[model samples]
Target: MTSVNDQTQIEQETGNTEGESKDSVKQEKEMKPEESNANSPTELSKLTKIVKHSKPEQPLGFDGFKKQYYRYASKFGTTLNLLVVGGSSLGKTTFVNSLIQGSLTGKKTAKTSDFMQHRLRMTDGDINFNLTILDTPGFGEKCDNSNCWKPLANILVQRLNAYFENEIKACRQLPIVDTRIHGCLFFINPTGHMLDPLELYVMKRIDRFVNIIPVIAKADMLTPEECARFKRNIIKDLQHEHIQFFHEPGKSIEGINYGMPEPFALIGATKGMQSDSKNAIRGREYPWGVINIDDPQHSDFCAFRNFLLYTHAEALIEKTHKVIYDALRTERLNKLKSQPNGFYTSSKKLVEEYMKAELGRVERSLRQTVQDKLQEKENLLAYTEKQLEAKHKEYEESLINRCNELKSQKQSLENLVRSDKTKKHSIFFK
Candidate 1:
C-alpha cells in the first residue's frame, strides 16, 4: 500500500533535516566562545564578565578565626563584673548568693564601707565566666542619706581607674583583666511607691559610668497588683526625674519599655523555706502556702535572672564597653589633653612626660636659684670693695689735713719759741 514517490519524499525530507542538524552543530563547534555570546544587555553582561563560576583558592569564611577565639575564651574564661548596691536589709546579700550559688566563701570585702567583692568561676550556657559580685552594705540606711552616693561613686571610679592603670602600661598586659563594673543592680525597696530622693540621686550619680538596673527588692512583700503598680510608679518617677537606667538606652524609641523588665520586682529566696512541691523550688514559706521565687506570679526573679545571664548579658557588656566605658575613656583623655603631649600620648606616657617636665622644672629652678645667689654674693663683694676704697680715700684726705694742721701748729710753735727766746723765755726754747 505504500507509494514509492511518497517514500522517496519522506527519505529526502529526513536526509535534509539530518544535514541541517549537522550543519548547526558544526557551526556551533566552529564559533569562538566570545562570538557565541548573546547580544542582549543582561546576557552580554553575564557572558562578558571575566570571572569564573567557581570560587578561587582564597580563604573567605571567618569560621577559623571564630573557632580560634572560642578556643581562647574556653581556655581563659570570659569575665563579668556586677556591682549590687542597695539599702540595708534589702536582700542584697541573699540575692547575690542566689545569683551564683556556692561561688563565694567568707565574705571578702573591699577596703571601702563594708563593700564586699565575691569572685567566683561559673558557667552560663557555653561561656566559662569569672563572675564578680560587688555588694554594698549600710548604704542609704542612715537618717542622712544625702552623701550615700559618694561611696558608690568612689567604687565605680576606682574600677575605671584600675582599668586605666592597666591600659597605660608600657608593655601592655596580654589579657587586661577587665574588672570594670559591667552592670549595677540598684535594689529599690518595694514600698509600692515612687523612688525616694536618696535612691534617685544615687542611681543618677553612677548611672553615667555604669549600667543601673533599677530593681524592686522584697517584691514578695507586695501583692501582684501592688507590684505592678509599683513598677509603673517607679517608671513614671524615673521618667519624671529624667533618670537613665540600663534599659533606657537599649530601647528603640523614647518612652518605650522593651523586652527586658524595667524596675524589675525581685524576691530573693531564703534557705529557711523550701517549696513543698515535688520540684522543691526555693521560696519564702507562708502560713497558707509556699511562695516560689521562680513563679512569675510571685516575683520577677526568674525573668531578671534570665535577662542578666542569657538574654541580654552581651547587651549589658556591649553598652558598658561602647557607651559607658567609651564615655569615661573620652572624658579621661580630654582631661589628660591638658598635659604636655597628652593628646597623642598614653596615660602612662603622659605621666612619664609630666614627671620629666617636673624634674626639668626643678632642675631649672635650682640652677636659677644658685645663679641668683652667686650673682647676689658677687654684687655684695663689689659693693663692699667700692665702700672700702671710698673709706680709704677719706682716711688719706683726713691724714693729709691732719699733717698740714700739725705742720702749721709746729711753725706757730717755732715762731712762739723764737719769740719766747727773744723775750728771754729759756724754758720755751728748750
Candidate 2:
C-alpha cells in the first residue's frame, strides 16, 4: 500500500479520469444552447408559416350566389299574402294575369264567386319566394251590400285565430307559415265622382286590419280631366271619412304634388294592342285613341305595381306582423286574462270538453294498438295449436303401426311353437 509504483499508478488513473470529465463538460457546454432551443418555443415559431388574409376581390359565381341566397331565404321564410277585394266585373283576374306575366294557373273566376286562393313562385335575382293571392270575387256585388265585408273580416279573424292557436301550442312548429292578409288591394269603380257609401263602409271597416290600397279600376273609361277630378274627390272623401290607406307616414308629403296621393288610378288589360307608333302596348284601344296602362302620364298602374311588388313590399309585410297581427294577438291574450267569472267558467268548460275529446281520441288509438297486438298473438297461438295437433296425430299413427307389427311377430312365434310340437310328437311315435 505504501509502494511508490502503486502511488504513481493511482495518480495516473486519477489524471485520466479528470481529463475524461473535462472533455464531457466541454461537449455538454457546446449542446447547452441547442437544449435550451429545444425546450423553448423558438423552433416551433420558425416552422410555422404566416399567411395574410383579405376579403375576396372577385364576386361569387351564380351557383355560389344562389347558395348564399337560399341561406338567406332559410333564415327568413318568404311567403307573401295579398287579398284582392272588388265588386263584379272589376277585371281583378285580368290585373293579376297582367301583373304576373301570364303565369296564373287558376281558372278564371265568375262574377259570383267565393274566396279562392292561388299560389305562384316569384323570383328576384337569386332569391325566390311564394306569392299567395286571395280573391274575394262577390264582395260588394250583392244588392244588399250591408253584410259583404263580414265574410272577409271573419276570414281574416279566422286566420289570425289559427296562427294564434299555433303560436300558443305546447310544441309549436318551426317557422310558422303566415297566412294572414298582408295587403288588401281594394278596386274602386271609375265613376268619375267620389267613393260610394258601400266602398267607404268596407274600407273603413277593414282598413284597421290590413294595408288597404284603393285603386280606381277601368280608368280608361274616364277622360284625363275627369280622372284627375275623380282622384281629387276620392282623396278628399277618404280624408274626410278618416279612412287609413297604405301611405308611408313620418315621411315628407312633398311627393303628393309630384304624383297623385293615396288612391291610385289603374287600368288593367291582359291583351296587348299596338299603338299609333306600331309599338305593342298594354292598354285599351278606344275609338278615340290608345291609353297605355304602363305610362305614368296615362295611368298610375306602373307606379302602383312598383309600389306593391317592389318598393313597399317589405313594408306591408312588416306592418302586418308588427302592427296588425301583434295588436290582435295582444288583444286576445288580454281578453283571456280579463275574463269575468261566468266567461271564465264557460271557457274552462270548453277547454275541459276539448281535453276530454282529445283524451278519448288518444285512448281509442291506444286501444286499437293493443287490439292489433292481441290479434297478432291470437293468430300465432292458433298456428302453434294447429302444428301441435298435427304432430300429435302423426305420433299416435306411428305408435299404432309399431304395435301392430309387434302383434304379428307374437302370432308368428306362436305358429312356430305349434309346428315344432307337432313334429316332436311324430318323431316319438316313429
User: For residues 233-279, what per-residue lDDT tens digits would candidate 1 score against the true structure?
Assistant: 99898879887777734553365334664578887764534466567
Give the TM-scores of the predictions, in the order they appear.
Answer: 0.61, 0.58
Predictions in order: lDDT: 0.72, 0.72
Mind sharing the TM-score for model 1? Answer: 0.61
lDDT of 2 by residue, 93-136 (tens): 77766666663333453454677788888777656767888877
lDDT of the structure predicted as candidate 2: 0.72
Q: How much is the lDDT of residue 139 in candidate 2?
A: 65
Candidate 2: Cα lDDT at 373: 100
Off by over 4 Å in 2: 1-71, 74-77, 103-109, 250-260, 340-430
Error of 2 at 204 (Å): 2.2
Count clashing residue pairs per candidate: 0, 0
Model 1: ten consecutive residues of lowest lDDT: 47-56
